[model samples]
Target: MLITGADLAAPALALLDDYEVVFAGKAPSPDDIVALCRRHDPVAIIVRYGKVGAAAMDAAPSLRVISKHGSGTDTIDKAAAAARGIQVVAAAGANAAAVAEHAMALLLACAKSVAVLNERMHAGHWDKATHKSMELEGRTVGLVGLGAIGLRVARMADAMGMRVLAFDPYAKDVPPFVQRVELDAIWRESDVISLHCPLTADNAGLLSAATLAACKPGVIVVNTARGGLIDEPALLAAIRSGQVAGAGLDSFAEEPMTPAHPFHGEPRITLSPHVAGVTADAYVKMGVGAARNALAVLHG
Candidate 1:
């Protein structure tokens, strides 16, 4: 067994007691993973972070399975793994609560300008007389996915008295409060839009300039899913032009966003370093899930 990151939860580590586990450091480039694969010839890989591609797959003739630490498997090359007869699996829903709560926090922050207010207060200024926050009640929120995390977010929005509209062609058993609708309805009618879908070839840049333009003016955008789903430049421009009133983002097109990134000084944007699912409880759950999944394939 080989782990892609420096650490895995101790409980998960216990599951691989019979195998020698190798760590690829905190941040590994593609070459690092390929080198480690060639050297260790690990039979299974638990991906905590970084991409797993064809080069790494070819390096490890003994590799049997690639398990994801979280729900999203976009970082792994599924086609390459399948071609080589290597199985791919994800710890789906392990981080649902953690990520759902973070999405809600981002939405609330954007709607209420929470970060802006905090900065203003710390700078010895109060805008109580001039500031007004958008009320969520009775407003429509459009969700792009209805998986575990999306379902939790829908329930949260419903509890707040917000009308929830969702677009997920494959979703079933949707709650009564959520109205299943087409993607066009989501764009045309929502006061707020939240994304909880995986990044796929078909939906990459789903929220492009044209799609952003179709949204209701002053709409709030929240994304806790893959960053590639939205065009970064288009989102930046939308915020600037007020096509998007505010944005709360937990992921980005690039990880470890550069200090000089365009969003750095943008006041209307709330940013988190894609750690929405990194809570202590979630870390353990995801790690355990990944370990179990890898073991299942290997033992079978």
Candidate 2:
């Protein structure tokens, strides 16, 4: 067994005690991961973070399963795994509350300009508090996906007196509080837009310059999903033009290397190191889930 990209703590990882669980360091690129597979020929690959492409699949001759640490498997190529009879499983809904809470925190921080205000205070400037801050109460929030995390966010927004408009073509049994609306309607009416969708070929670059232009001016965007879901250049431009009031982003095209990131100095965006679903509680659940999934595939 091999664990790549991120840490999987001892307790849950102990489930694979019968096998050798190797941790190949952190922040390795897709090619690096494939090279590791070429050398190790691990029976199972637990992709906690980063990509597992066709080349990686080709490199793993002994691979029987590919287990994802979290809900979204966008970074792993499903087709490549399928071609080699590799079973791919993910720990869905295990980290829903953690991700939902992080999204809400981002929303609140942006609404209150927490990032900007804190910097101002540290810089010895104190006049910004008098400025108006947007409140969640009574504002319409559009959620791009209605998965477990999205549903959790919907429930939380309801408690805060915010209307939730969710768009999910395949979603069913949506609660009465959330209005299932078309994607265009969300762009037209939402004061805040939150993304909870996985990255797919059809939805990659979903929030491009054209779509951002269609959105209500000064709309606040919060994305905890894939970075490719939003065009970084377009988002940066929108922020500069004030078309986007602010953004709370937990993912990026390039991440875990924040010092040279473009969003590092941008006050209009509140950034996180993709740790939204990495709470202590979620980590255990994800690790145990991945271990069981891999063992199931190996035994079957």
Candidate 3:
């Protein structure tokens, strides 16, 4: 059997229909995943939203492959899959443009207070127009990562006439337009800071309280990466204290944030339902890539 931990685009699932495909159903909790896998004994598991760990892997002796719907493998217990000889594949760079564009959308939204102004305009208020909005040109943008998505963001930032500073120990052959800099300079000088790195044990809370404290006053932050990169409680405290002026967050420490979540009521935060990489074009690419990976493992 083939199984999908979360819903995939119809096209991708259609490719696997030659086999007995099963759905893990909606918003499955961790326990639900183990039960679903054990019940189905899926040979191939495509994990989009659910966590696949040692328990789920151990449940299925026939499990042959595990495919991540996107680039990150932090959600999957990779070591466990390897121990059981299950091939793991990811659709890297499939959504780089979509994610980079979403990061820019968040940056522009925060800089201009576009959402706030639109709401005010609808309320028949024009007082906000008298106040100055933040400008993008000539300001400095510090990037925390320089991978495919981050590189794309760098190009866009340069096109906007902004000086780009970056911190990526793994990156080389630095572009002339992007000045590779240290972390200290990023926090000390940049007006805008964005994160585009993957989540790992070494840097889980890289943007913790101490890091935030070092940022320039009223610094705007945009996170298009994993939610675990920042400590949500500490971030909320900083926002409440007004040290971090505004945030554009596409991911969160927790998914499916409740309506009454504190971030929802904060005016300085702009939220999206983690759709940064879910544009129609990227969605199709990811779906097809994941489907093809599963088929290769199953047939080979």
**Best lDDT goes to which candidate?**
1
The alpha-carbon lDDT assigned to residue 166 of candidate 1 equals 100
TM-score of each: 0.99, 0.94, 0.93
- Model 2 misplaced regions, further than 4 Å: 257-260
As for candidate 2, its clashing pairs are none
Ranking by TM-score: 1, 2, 3
Q: Candidate 2 residues 76-111, lDDT tens each?
A: 889988988998999889889899999999999999
lDDT of each: 0.96, 0.89, 0.88
Writing each residue's lDDT as its tens digit, candidate 1 over 36-119 gives 999999999999888999999999999999999999999899999999999999999999999999999999999999999999
Candidate order, lDDT descending: 1, 2, 3
lDDT of 3: 0.88
208 in model 1: Cα distance from truth in Å? 0.9
**In model 3, which runs have C-alpha deviations exceeding 4 angstroms?**
none
